[model samples]
Target: MNQLNRTTANIQTIRPIKVIQFGTGNFLRGFTDWIIDMLNEKTGFNADIQMVQVHGKRPATEVEKQEGLFHVITRGYQQGKIIDETRLITCVRGAVNPYLDYEGFLALGENPDLEWILSNTTEAGIYVDESDIDPSQPPASFPGKLTALLYRRYCKGGELLNKALHILPCELIEANGQKLKECVNAYADRWKLPDGFVAWHSRQVHYYNTLVDRIVPGYPSDEAAEIQQRLGYCDELMVVAEPFHFWAIEGPEYLKELFPTGQLGLNVLVVPDLAPYRTRKVRILNGAHTTIVPLAYLKGLRIVKEAVDDPFIGTFLQDALHSEIIPSMDMDPSGLEQFAQDVLDRFKNPFIRHQLSAIALNSVSKFRVRVLPSLIGYIRKEGKLPPCLITSLAALLVFYRGRYKGEPLPINDTEEVMAYFSDIWKSGEPYELVPRVLAMVPFWGLDLNQYPGLSNAVIREVRALLDEEKVWLV
Candidate 1:
């Protein structure tokens, strides 16, 4: 079989490098790169990407070897149909590891056609690294590297108004673009960069907070040989993803024209504010995951699809989403319902075996972010505790006990969190544990016991869970 290279793959056309991507991960390839390739094929966008390695010391050898050619196989259920389609994505011109050749990485900023910067360097990637004070060398952080690159562009353009770049960071953190911009400004301040450069950056560069959703399970190692045989080529960088995708960008109206993925009938929305969308995702999609995991895992379910397919767990998830989570959201009811449906469909995807243990990692923090908002919101609106959410909370506490039905539960979290749960479970009293856990301010950031009837409701559910040995779906 031929290696999946430009020459072997018969990909002769090369587009201009208009996009500089920060991460060469599965998500970017399966989501952003796929979208760009569609735009190029469908809308005459005529653009390619230059990928930069952010964290790794080594280069993307597969990408470099293949000349940035790979296949994206989108497999899932959509609209009552099984969607399994593959596309050859050739939009990535090449990759550059900044750690290896900092000058070559910086040289990308000097490209006149470079108009956009996209990144998915994980949540922790967007931070202020105080050690990266020296601008002469490659900075230690993502923001620092971006600052150096932008400074080079600012210098090269010499006050040219068209030189400003549009930055869209797809990190899962809230207000990602604003946070990244803040980090870059902090870097400038720390390094004592010129006021003019800062002014140019503020005026010229556009940072848009974005929400991206897609399940890109990269490198199907088990199916690699079979997939290669089917395609009659060897592609080491092949990425597997679901058919559903969404990118909500909070930016000016001009962004619709600038990057017209929406025109391709893709779920790319340019909105004035991303707050409602973010809240919708948190309360519905993520809330469902966090709520279902503990109960389902306790019931001997291992994967997300298995949990969602089981009658009991599936009903619990649906009830929680429609009855508790969606009602708590402030968005349009119809829109919320549709989003919930989409989330359920994604969860039911058979191609992705999302591990319950993987989702259970850092579950304390996950609950605080994904489930607590809905719980608080429901209480605020209806003046009563949401039954499903409270029940899920009970399940979560029991799950933290680290043993379920004589089997060791896969509980992954901080040492402090683990020790706290371990110490509490030693008492072996649900009645006493419920209120005490609620009152711990370090865990919840506020005393959840302060909410009227909240602690009592949790205690009631916890008692039921301990005594009944099954989730009492409200």
Candidate 2:
């Protein structure tokens, strides 16, 4: 079989590069780049991407070796059908690693066609690095590198509004685009860049807070042989993802004209605000995972599909989602219900082996951010504690005890979080444990014990869960 490249793939396009993407990872390739390719084909949005590697350790060797050509293999259940599709991606022009050639990386800023910047450097990518003051060298952080690039662009086109790039950060953090902008501004102030550049960035540049959803498992290692055989080529960059894809971009409606993804019946939404959508995803999808992980794992379930398939666990998840999580959010009830159902369906996707233990990592923080808001919201709305959420909270605390069925469970988290749980869990008594955990202001941002009857409910659930009593929340 031939290597997957432009020639072997019989692909040729010389579109102008309009995007400089940070992080040439699987998610971006399968989700963002795939969307761009669709836009180019369907809407005549003839724009190419120049992928820039943020991590300084190595260049984008695989992307370069394959000549920015790859395949996105979509294989999963969607709309009561198993959809298997493959598309050869051709929107990526090439790649550059700033660590190897800073000038080449900086040269991307000079491209006249460049109008947008996309990134998914993970949640930790957008931050201020006080040490990264020198702009002459490649900065150590994602925001620092982006700031350097924007400065280069600013220098090339002084006071030109069109030159300013629309930054779309796909990081999972809340207010991601705003956070990234703050980081860039912090760098500019620390490095003492020109006042004109700062003003230009503030006035012209647009940073869109975006929420991207797609499970890109990347490289189908187990089925690679069969897949490559069917495709009749060796694609080192083949990314496996689900059929369901959605991108909620918080921007002006004019973004529809700019990106035009929605024009082709794509699941992309350019809305005035992304709060509802963000809350919907975090509280429902992520919340379901965090809620199910501990309890399901304790029930001897390993993967998400198995947990969701189990009758008892399935009902528990659905009840928690529809009864508690969705009702708490201030959105269209029908829309929220549909999204919640979609989330449950995604969890039952057989093609994806989402491990419970994997989701259990940093579960303390996950619970606080993902589920706690809804739990409190339900209480405020109904004037009573949500039974399912409280049970999950107890299961979480019990799960952190780090043992189940006489075997040590894999509990991954920061040293501080782990130590805090370790110290609180030393006492075998549920009453003592519940109060201490609830008073953790640093974790939940408030004394969760303050909620009327919350401590008692949690204590009861904790005792039940610890005693190995089958106290199903639903």
Candidate 3:
């Protein structure tokens, strides 16, 4: 089979490089680059990407070998139909690692056509490094590198306002774009870049806080040979992702013209504020995953699909979503419910073998962020505790017992958290355990015992779960 490249794949044309992308990872390739390719084809947004490796000394050899051509294989269920499709992506012009070729990477900033900066250096990628004070060498941090690039661009273009770049960070952190801007400013201050250049950056640079959603389980090694055989091309850079993709950018409405993925039947949204959308995702999709893991795993389900397929677990998840999660949110219930249903459908996707144990990692923090908000919201709104969520909390407490059915359960958390649970569970009594856990103000942000009847309800549920009575099911 021919190696997947521009020539072997019969890809003739390449667009002008308009985007300098950081992090040549699967999530960015599968989600953002895929959208850009579609936009180029459908909306005549003729632009390509200059991929950059942010970490380590190694450049993306696959991208280099393939001449920036790869395939994104999207497989999953959406709207009750199974979707399995592949597209050859040709938007990436090439990749350069700053550590390997600092001059080449910095030279990207001088491109006259380059208007946008895109990145997904994970949540930790955006941070201030006070020691990154030299522009002569490649800085260690992502924002430091970006500040250097921006300085180069500023100097190259004589600090022209029009030369300022549109930065859209796809990092998972909240206010990622804003945080990146802060880091850049910190670097500028530390490096003592000219006042004029700093002013130009402050006035002209566009930073957009964006929320990206897609499950890009990269490099499907187990099925790579079969996939390559089907395509008749060996693609080392192939990325596997779910069909569902959404990008919510908190920016001006006019910025839509730059993207325009909405017109291409894509789920990209450019709005004045994306808090509602973020809340919706956190409360419903993430909430569902966090709520299901402990309980479903206790029920002997190892993977997400199996848990969602089981009648009892599936019903429990559904009831928790429609009855508790959605109602807890302030959005239009109809839209919320639709999104909740779609989330459930996504969970049932067979292509993604989402392990419950993986999701179980740091579940205490996950529960605090994902599920606790809805639980509190339900109490505040309806003046009562949500049954399913309350039961799930009990299940988490039970799951933290470190063993189930005389076997060690896959409980992954910090040593401190593990120790806390271990020491607390020594009582072997729900009555004693429930109150101590409930009063864990440091964990849950407040004493959960303050909520009337919360401790007692959890005690009952914990007792039920421990006894294997199935009374909660009844």
Best by TM-score: 3
In candidate 3, stretches whose alpha carbon ends up further than 4 angstroms from where it belongs are 158-161, 469-474
Q: Write the per-residue lDDT of candidate 1 for residues 275-384, one digit (tens) a residue.
A: 98888888788889999999898888999999999999999999999898878877789999998899989988988989999999999999998999899988888788
lDDT of each model, Cα atoms only?
Answer: 0.91, 0.89, 0.90
What's the TM-score of every candidate structure? 0.95, 0.93, 0.97
lDDT of 2 by residue, 59-118 (tens): 788899889999999988776777789999999988999989999999888888888899
| Least well predicted 10-residue stretch by lDDT in candidate 2 | 465-474
* Candidate 2 total steric clashes: 0
Please give, for residues 1-474, the per-residue lDDT of candidate 3 as tens digits.
999888888888978999999989999999999999999989978999999999889768888999999899999988889999999888998999999999999988888888899999988889976667678998999999998888888888743457657899999999998899999988988888899889989988899999999999999999999999999999999999999888999999888887788789898999999799899998899899999999998888999999999999999999999999888877899989888878987898989999999999999999999999999999999999999999999999999999876668888899999999999999899998899888988899999999999999999998888777344334
Q: Rank the candidates by lDDT, best first.
A: 1, 3, 2
The number of residue pairs in model 1 that clash at the backbone is 0
